[model samples]
Target: MQSSSKLFPVALISAELRGDLTEDVYLLKPNNSPDPSVELALTRLGRAGHDGARGVPVVLLHGSFANRRVWYTTGGQGLGAWLARAGFDVWLAEMRGHGLSPRNRLYRDNRVADYARYDLPAIAAFVGEQCAAPAHWLGHAQGGLVLAAALGGGYLAAAQLASLTLCGSQISRLHGVLELPPLIWAARLLLRRREQVVAGWVGPGEGYEEEPAGMVRENLRWFGRFGEGRQDWAAGLVEVTIPVLALAGAADRSAPPAACRQLLERFGSPLREYLCLGRAEGFAEDYGRAAMLLGGNAHNEVWPLLEYWLRHQRLPERR
Candidate 1:
């Protein structure tokens, strides 16, 4: 399959630290398919009126069961826009199934691991090719896992990435949470009626839809099971050495503070930082009202802090 392109008006925001900001939509071709069509969807947000010498490029990766839009709607403050205004090029990625990508009808082949093998590596390589300078990687939830796996596998070259940041993510199998009895029932029902579940989850939207057959089956194969606690691929996180920042939500039942800490602890980086935001942080309160981090409320509260860290690293002499 050949790649296709479409443009959309992504929400943009300006930040206090940088000059101007703007966001754009993008579609990336998949690398592995025999006929490999556009395998990824993304949004590119850039800082206005700044040369590449001003700062490093930043790539934002969204979590599981979510597309790039989640970051924008949730409280990201259009993180891409803010980062761009802050003088950093920003890119937000949508893994195959969640948003603006093609839909998958096959259930037997879906598994979450495909993200690491296909999506994450593809995004990293794409950024390396597009950006004039090394970029920093920011990921939330499963997005973090994909990054870790990519780094572990050597898909993310050190020369191409300045650092890695994870929000509401963990590397320990013990950190996972499932909705329990209800989730179990839901999974069983989904197994029997995958199409209905896919349709319900992927409501009509400008850039949101179902994933492809092989990719969806692969995601389900790994992440399909439901229960109180389940884990896979957490062991790969320990291999990353890039500077890391791990952020968590105090009220997030899915990825609790304790688990997030446990996950961050596995990272051996000397520059690692960890933060946890309370409900009072109002990260999600403004979700859907304005573009925050990427469209995510959690990411919005965390973006400024991340920008501060990135800025400091980029301009150590200022400190």
Candidate 2:
């Protein structure tokens, strides 16, 4: 149940069979975090038949107000299961106080800064240690922003990563209404009154939890439409030279294609590539924020493209 290495402690909760795939969940405590009670939950999905051998490692991070279910479902579906079936070592990470991860002492006070500064690197290091190789990372929406913050702050080293993918993530989108203090207060009040949807595909009911107010405040600050300006992302982001892929949803009003493109353009990686998911780009339909990963056509159309990109570290071959 519980195990420890010299570095930190890793507790294996359970290993169950999800049809043809194996699911293993662990609670990882990183010693570097300011809060010792901060433990992250990671679910590993692997296929049968490969003795113990693992293919390339891939870590999937969900957006804010979401959890691991964003990339995986209990029925062994979603991108995480698909990657596992394809022989890649796939990890679904649940942020602190979300899903399988329990709340820390200062859970409500947590911010993206806390996640980027401590949590992400810890997860990456643990993955690398297990697979003995740098792992690829994919972030959706706010998850992508966390990745960018980690890289920009020099918290996650390039050597620790194989590649980076930001799906429908951008900081350039300005929400002018959030600038008003009264509106910000009202937003928090509303979030408390309603169920926060963690599973975007599940629609307005169930799979919900209340998000921390501190995180909401930090998110607003990042927009720079109010409060002080955001951190100087360029200094650290331009230093990131890892292979990068930035994907945008054509119909995603939350993060438009132009904003996504702007984020990708700031990266220093010479191998940077941009993709727009829409009919014009040969995709089945114009993807929205959540549809980019959960739409009906995603498995048949988008997943294959992701697999190819991860394997080749290049753009997928067009049909």
Candidate 3:
């Protein structure tokens, strides 16, 4: 299966030596992409002493305006590193113009429609070739939406996926003004003069990278119709049948638990699970958006539940 990977065209850009693990970065340029200069980065983290024997392949995707740092810090302290240390073949993906991936010609014009239709399928195919097995996909925010779009559009086949996990992501929650097409159209029209939108200037976070206004436009469209281009992804979601795990933070007003549950309900999977992180859910605190994953107590509280689910495909027992 590994030998067949050569059939796909991928360029290995660099290999960085981490303490105990090796990080191999590959740039995948799918032939079908509208932009020939587009190259999506896929970073693989694994150790050598395991004799190349890998556990299940798991792909980690970052949210909007974020990068690979969401999964692993420079010090190798996040979930990507933890999963690598645990023997899972982990791959962290950087969407166009994010993290290690350089901006493509269409960077300003790229949207989730391009990501879900073009980038993700290429990533999955590359991972599938290397691992010779289906991957378990885990994403946060816009990353989750990309996964949903890929699954719903049939860009990613069920045979290429082991499971799906969504964190702090939902389309059910509507942003009143943001949901209006005319307003979004006006925003995009205004953004034509701007190259990128800084998360700190507009949203609640700091240190986030600048993102294409196209992403904001696409998200608004999803919030309004859950469809992109000509495809009705909202209607297509019911066709996804893989086991799914959806998580929400109790204090995450951005993506409330109720909204996340609505997204979970749309999946056709028989094995669907939902969990809300808060004192009511037996957690120490009511986790907010980033707090749910990167909080000080997450290592002891949240990470274990994620590991358990990735390993067992079931909810962990209440403490």
Candidate 4:
């Protein structure tokens, strides 16, 4: 069995007000095992007095091979900073393998699902505990996939969220066919020569600077066994009726236009809304289509649309 904990230097921004933002690095340690020594430097943001609201909070999760910085560069200060200016607290999460998140030790047996289990759940719990109100959940790409897994596994319930938004998410394995074959080949080659695969992905000598060895191993494992488990989880998309919004970029190769359509069709929420940028919306003129899909550009393009939806949303009575 393995346990994970958050470790990092904490800096206080305000002494009297007790207002601060802390950088948390995480590590997964197996029972009785020597500490792995490497850790993922997970970054999170906290703000107070946002948007006329005293403490509304929103948690943003970044995608694969990316750190939370994408939200700043591509997602633009317009989104996160705007929310903060509007009186909402905002937090961003960097997954284990990317960005500031590093590993606890040099080990070669980690998998992506390890993140699905450890990193994601921990972040969700932390948000639930720390926020003044149930936070709004937003995920992009692989982040979206992780959130879907958490929701399907009963890790996120309506009580834990103000709303759930999936941007460029792949809700069904039916859409993963594009990468299945190559992923299988990669797994086979890794099985035959694990060191070579790890070296290629994790690189050489730059051990401490490289991603967690365990995360590299785990990603391989998840990609190899792809659709074997969780048909029920895939089917459970229909049950996510909590004022959901599904956004897609018209030009996304990973989660193509067809896949986006299928996801919206499968989801059973009456209040659900779908926005396809670069199609009939003429969103391509303002923002590059690719940028729209990769970040929150699509969401920003349709901010007015979301606002209307939000106004109509009948939030459950708070407990």
Candidate 5:
């Protein structure tokens, strides 16, 4: 089916060998989307030894106000690098307007609905084609929201995924009245008066690409609502029987542990599991949204668990 579309997922632009890692970057454009011209960037990482193995692929999706680099930086101090070294075929997806992906024509008006319905499926299809098997997906923070929406909408078919993991992501958690409908609307009001929300300009994070105003408004509405405007999320989740993992941070007020649990409980998958990173859980320290992925001690503490999870998900080969 992917082969028939004019804007199908496979459009390889560059394949370069960088040391022990082989990096292949592709520009994916899904013709099924409202904007077929919207192009997303996907980066695949593998080693020469595993090139013949064709391990079931694992794709990493970053959260809002961030890009693909969040999964790995130049020094290779991120989960994407860690996963590759652990012998998993890794792919990093940069959503529209993030990282190396160029902003779409409707950049200011882009929303998560578009991402869930369009970008997620394309990433899955492309990775599945490259690996010749269903892929496991891990989404962090806002990326988790997008993944849930896609799963709910059935945009990510069950046959396309071996497992699903969500880290530091929930739709119903609200920090305060700051996310109330009134404040949300007000934020959109203020943002519409400008071009986009530049997080670093507004605060003290690294100056990355500004987020679309439409995305902010759409996400703000989800602060207190689960299944944000998704027509198929409830139905799609009811049919998902695959292994599912939802990871939360004990100290994360941004996406509280309880909220993450609520998301898992509401799902119909029987194999659903939850992990909270906290001292009580026998972790070194409580992990926040960022710390769960980028903390100094993640490699030593949580990454091994991630490695184990993916490795265990591999189906036993029949003789």
Candidate 6:
């Protein structure tokens, strides 16, 4: 399944070396959306002068309220860099209205449906076109949710997508006062009035990006419905047979371990695996949502597992 948008005006905006890694940034115009102003920014990482002749292509997607920087910080190495150095064609995607991707004409009106149904599939097609091979996908938090929706919604197909990896994303686990109908109504009302959710309003850190109220509201709707409005998210995922690896933070209150397990159970893929990080699971300490991908511990302990998983996927022949 291809994206509804047309691709054009693709450009490589910058290229620089970071500690033996070559980072190149590209901009892609889908040429169609509710808003014509939106464009996607993809960052490519590889060794200097290295061609695609010997590597599997991998796409790294960041969570909500974040940008492409989630994959790597300036002058610093992250998972994408590690994967590149490990011989994978790594592409980091910045979602619409986040990071290098500018807000579109209907920015506030955008929904996860738009992301799953249009943006990601389009980006995948573009990456495949450039690499001449299907791409392995790794998504964190909200990025994972969008990936699930895309595959389950039929906007993305196994033909062009080799495998999937999700970190800190789950469809259920909303509880207590957060699930009260009146509370949901009040939250939606408040979100509709606010232009955006500010950074630092979320976690106790420096990385969260500002997000449109519509995005928050749409998420709230899912939380309230406990599913994607009319679709059975669990059932949809059950139909997908791609290999999947779901990593969860044991101490993640945002998306608890049990909830993440629920997500894992819903996948019909016979090759699916779920790993929860915590001391009980043989790790030094329990990890939280952000810690799943960030921090020194993640780099030292978690990154290798991811590397091993990606290494198992062979590059697909160009169709």
Which candidate leads in TM-score?
A: 3
Summarize candidate 6's per-residue lDDT along 1-319 as a digit string, tens digits.
3332246667777778877888888777776566667788888888766764538899999987888778887756778877888888999999888888878777777778888777887788788777767888999888888888888777788778778998988888553466677887888888887877887544455257888778778877886343465776557877898888888898887788888788878888888888888888777679888887776698877887788888774322212
Best by lDDT: 3
Compose the digit string of candidate 1's lDDT tens values, residues 291-317.
223444535455666788777743112
- Stretches > 4 Å off in candidate 1: 1-22, 48-54, 73-77, 104-108, 171-193, 196-233, 279-301, 313-319
Candidate 5: TM-score? 0.89
Taken over the whole model, the C-alpha lDDT of each candidate is 0.56, 0.82, 0.84, 0.51, 0.78, 0.79
Model 3, position 317: C-alpha lDDT score: 83
- What would the TM-scores of all predictions be? 0.68, 0.89, 0.94, 0.67, 0.89, 0.90
Better of 1 and 4 by TM-score: 1
Worst 10 residues of 2 by lDDT: 197-206
- Give the RMSD in angstroms, all C-alphas superposed, for model 2: 3.4
lDDT of 1: 0.56
Model 6: CA > 4 A from native: 1-7, 52-54, 175-177, 202-207, 224-229, 313-319
Model 6 has a clash total of: 0
Each prediction's total of clashing residue pairs, residues at least 3 apart in sequence or on different chains, is 44, 0, 0, 24, 2, 0
Model 5 shows how many backbone clashes?
A: 2
Badly placed stretches (over 4 Å) of model 4 are 1-53, 74-78, 106-112, 171-183, 186-231, 264-268, 285-290, 293-319
How displaced is residue 96 in candidate 1, in Å?
1.4
Please report the TM-score between candidate 1 and the true structure. 0.68
RMSD of each: 7.6, 3.4, 2.5, 7.6, 4.3, 5.0
Model 3 alpha-carbon drift over 4 Å, by segment: 1-5, 174-186
Residue 82, candidate 3: alpha-carbon lDDT? 88
Lowest summed lDDT across 10 adjacent residues in model 3 is found at: 1-10
Stretches of model 5 off by over 4 angstroms after superposition = 1-9, 200-207, 228-236, 313-319
Ranking by lDDT: 3, 2, 6, 5, 1, 4
Worst 10 residues of 6 by lDDT: 310-319
